[model samples]
Target: MTLPRMKLTDPKALRGYAHPLRMALLGLLRQQGPMTATRAAEQLGESVASCSFHLRQLAKYGLAERAPGADARERPWRATARATSWDDDSDDPQVRAATDELNAAQLALYTRQAEEFLARRIDEPTEWRAVTGFSDQSLYVTAEELAELTGRIDALLAEYDDRITDPSRRPDGFRRVSLIQLAVLSASPGGGPAPAASANPVEATPAAEPDAAR
Candidate 1:
């Protein structure tokens, strides 16, 4: 099946979609299908009123819409598309700025998810713990090569897209997984190592965990 997608070109729509909660709500609807504000609130641990407000905002930008409910008074919201996209290479300043904000919000979510998994991973199945963890690789490639690599990865992931919208297509042990891929330049252009650096540099220290859980 061809998955529906929402392509955001308007700066206003991009800005509106940049909120963390709104992004989370859209994700929930896409993964779990149609749901009322009350049900979405229960799943997201957010207020029903807040969910209602955000759902309306999403609808304004054509990201979501009201789905059929059991009765007239019961209204449910559904994501308009299974995937969202925007022009990362847009020359428009407003579009670029809005895209940056949206990217930051998305990265924050990914970081939180990784941290949460690390915090409770001990309780997970041994097989899962073995396979789930972070790894970074420094690749030496031209811009075109990098783009091709990412495209290949996207194509590989697309093989499983059908299972996302059709639960029956999933295997018995199937579970939801978030695979975050980031490819970017490692250093500034036309710049070399700092003069103060030693031949063998020490690894940077890791940041301390926050006192309170998010």
Candidate 2:
């Protein structure tokens, strides 16, 4: 099945999703699959009541829904979409605030995942150990080029998206890997947005000194 993606443009929806626990629950459903609140709570080390409430809240905002086989007493929930997206260019103050809240929650979760991986990395198989670690790099490119780069990256990641919602697709000895990708535009020396590369790129900026290269 194709990955479902919801682009949230409503401020009300953004506000509804501002809660950290709700974010976590939604992420769990998206990354895993249909799960009862009790089971999700157990996995998250949270109360079943809390998980149930949050799952309902997510449903209210169209972020999640009842699974096909779910019933009143044995209800199982699943994310309505594989991913939720919001544009940073929103003009509404409420939406901006809600976006900030969501971003902070996402960053916290990312940090936790990174720390957890590091803590247990030593015990992982040698093949995994050799491939896992933080990889940071920067490049100078035009805005259009950066957009293309991100699109290409998304296409590459889409190849593995099926594994998340389909356990059967998971290969032997393979585990879920969290790939946090960020394409941020670096600021110029003056601390503002960097200018696009000029036609004469060489003349746009002075060549770095040998000592400054490092």
TM-score of each: 0.86, 0.78
Per-residue error at 181 for model 1, in Å?
0.9
Model 1 / residue 211 / CA error / Å: 30
RMSD (Cα, Å) of model 1: 7.0
Clashes of 1: 0
Error of 2 at 133 (Å): 1.5
In the range 129-187, model 2's lDDT, one tens digit per residue, is 76666654557778799889888977997798667667889899875555666566555
Question: Per-prediction RMSD in angstroms?
Answer: 7.0, 10.7
Clashes of 2: 0
